[model samples]
Target: MLWLRSIIYYFLTALIALAISAIAGTVWGVAFALCVVSIACLFHIFNLHRLHRWLENPQVDNVPGSFMLWQEVFDQIYAEVRKQKKAKERLAGTLDRFLSAAEALPDGVVILDDNDRIEWCNPASCEHLSLNRKLDMGQPITHLLRYPSLRDYLKQQDFSHPVIIRITRPAEQTLSAQIVPFDSTRKLLLSRDITQLERVQTVHRDFVANVSHELRTPLTVVGGFIETMIDMPSSDAATRETHLQLMYEQTQRMQRLVEDLLTLSKLESGAQVREEEVDIPQLMQLLRTEANGLSQGRHTVEIGRLDRPRLIGNHDELHSALGNLVSNAIRYTPPGGTITIGWEKRDDTACFTCRDTGIGIAPEHIPRLTERFYRVDRGRSRNTGGTGLGLAIVKHILHRHQAQMIITSDLGKGSEFAVKFPQARVIE
Candidate 1:
């Protein structure tokens, strides 16, 4: 429409020029027409120059508003420019949000070009792979990782399953890494820290093996004795009685092992701890009697410095914990060795201390004493009728009571196992 209007205006000017020529002299009409055409050309030229400059550094606010038909052209161009600018801003905002989410992830994220060059990575990836964003960008991923297995994993491009790799750059860490094709020219390298998970799995395997190994010996012994009795049924009564006695003892040992395993399991089951007001002095007396019976008068069991403070805890659990300590002292100590059980306040906290003049533990073994089935002398532990889960049970019980166990020992010079209770658990 604007172009049609511009053409019509030019045509009218020509008619006016013709009319002037008919009315006036020919030279005068020609000069007037030339003046009008030049002015019109100059006006269009000025607006065209403004449009060229604005296009060089275009802004919606600075779009040239020209005369007549050119004004319509500028308005359309300005609106289109504004629309494109808004679309660009929206795209930028979406990209920013995606980057922010990737940065906040705990798992590592790395982007790789088709050539396996390092493109971009999150902070977690930097820590996991020991990568410097400014320095390592554009470097080959294989060169930085430097592991044969990982190099093979990338070359294979078989990303159906994640591969576990141990990295030693930053520290000893286990990472589960997988490649995902993100775009036509790039891939996403996702890594997760599975160090703890790997450790847990290893421990689980060990636990199962240990349990089987522990149960195997007794089962074999029981099976052997029964076979022997079955084969020698006509043997003398005394010999038969001895075989039966040995079998009975083996069965008893198996019973003890199964019982201890159950106790340990219960402690670890996250069950609520039983709470009750417990009398410390009375419990100590009961422990003394039990220790004497277990000692069989071979060792001296004495009560020392028994504080009159009552404690707040599970009565039966406390007894079990304290009894295990006393029994351990008795079992490890030789004939005529002294074992002392005491309950007293030290540093404003109630302490249950079992000090013994036994064959003391080595410093290295002390840290692992509470681990299930861990023994300083496996043969001696078996002979002394230990299921090897006593200290482990003690540990769990003390933890439930909000207490800490401190062990101090000198090799061959006896040891002290102490339980310190928090102030909240002690009723003075």
Candidate 2:
């Protein structure tokens, strides 16, 4: 192409010069035409000198801050470099944001290449799926994960449904996993931990079964008693009194059980609570006075400054919670055992303590104390008319208020229940 264009240019220039010379020969002379041709030749030689000098001088290629792009070859190369630079910058930004968001996600994320090789993994994936990213990257996804269910699920290539795996290799966890395929090449594996949700569901199921079973016996006893009384010809005075008292006690027991069930359900279902500034001093005084009245000179009561700590919560609920604690203390304590009510500011928290020289709880039973209907000693609890839900209610109350509870007991040294009220719920 270069040779053809150069040949065409020379022919065109020769034709133009010949025409000029022919016209000049007729007007002037052969000598004048020769002079015109010579001048044109000299001018061409001068331009060639400048072009050759540039090639000889290396500095001529250098411009301010960069190589000169005066030549066609340099210009083409420079344009290609600029395009690549911009593309690199755009790709770098996209990669940075993608990695940042992937890191922030709570669920596990795994990226696979077209060859089903592990390309990338998030921190959560490493923790939940038990795979070391450093050793697993670039490895086949199947060889590393080694989960039979997952392997079978992936082989089917069905993304229409998510497969849940109860992970239990290094530790126990539940995962809801989904595989999303892209362009028949790459795949995205995502998994979320649903251990807590599964645990709650199991607890609910067990609770329903146990509650129904427990109620059956009480209901059956009451039913048989009612039937017998109905068939007893309206009952004699002695029999009537005996049956009536027993029925009343059973009725009360049912009432307490129903009330506790409702309370627990409300607490679990995120029920709204009324919060107010609870005066610790006034509340303590009231509880002490109530304890005295209920004591009937049985137990000695001691009250302290309580650091004048203030808390914020529903007064009515707090009253019920506090009253239950005090009542339990009094009921469990021996005639001469001392009961002390006090509060103190520890760090940013206000702790309300109810220490009693009462019947202490066993170590093995402490863990399930907050469980609904759990009893350390069932016979003792029923004899004392305890509903087996006092600690459960206290636990839920503290949970709603974002507080905490600590129960410390020695087999025979009496128990101390310290309820830690967080600063978020404290007025002072």
- Per-model clash counts, in order, read 0, 0
**Per-prediction TM-score to the true structure, in the order listed:** 0.82, 0.71
Worst 10 residues of 2 by lDDT: 61-70
* Candidate 2 wrongly placed segments (more than 4 Å): 1-88, 113-115, 155-160, 168-170, 210-217, 264-282, 289-313, 331-338, 343-351, 399-404, 420-428
Per-residue lDDT over 27-105 for candidate 1, one digit per residue giving the tens place of the 0 to 100 score: 8789889999999989988988999999899987888887578888898999999999999899999999999999999
Q: Residue 336 error for model 1, in Å?
A: 1.2
lDDT of 2 by residue, 1-428 (tens): 44465566556666666676687653444455556568656755654565455446524234112121224444554466667778988999999999999988999999988877889999998876778978999988888665788878878878899888887767788888889886668999888999999999987897787577556756776787788888996688898778778878777877877888898778779878778788878888899999998888899988864687678888877877877888888888888998898888889898888889987888998888888777777777767777777878888887777878888987777988888887887776
Model 1 lDDT at residue 118 = 91
Predicted structure 1, TM vs. truth? 0.82
**Number of the top-ranking candidate, with lDDT as the measure:** 1
Q: How high is the lDDT of residue 101 in model 2?
A: 93
Clashing pairs in 1: none
Please, what is the whole-model Cα lDDT of each candidate in the order they appear? 0.90, 0.78
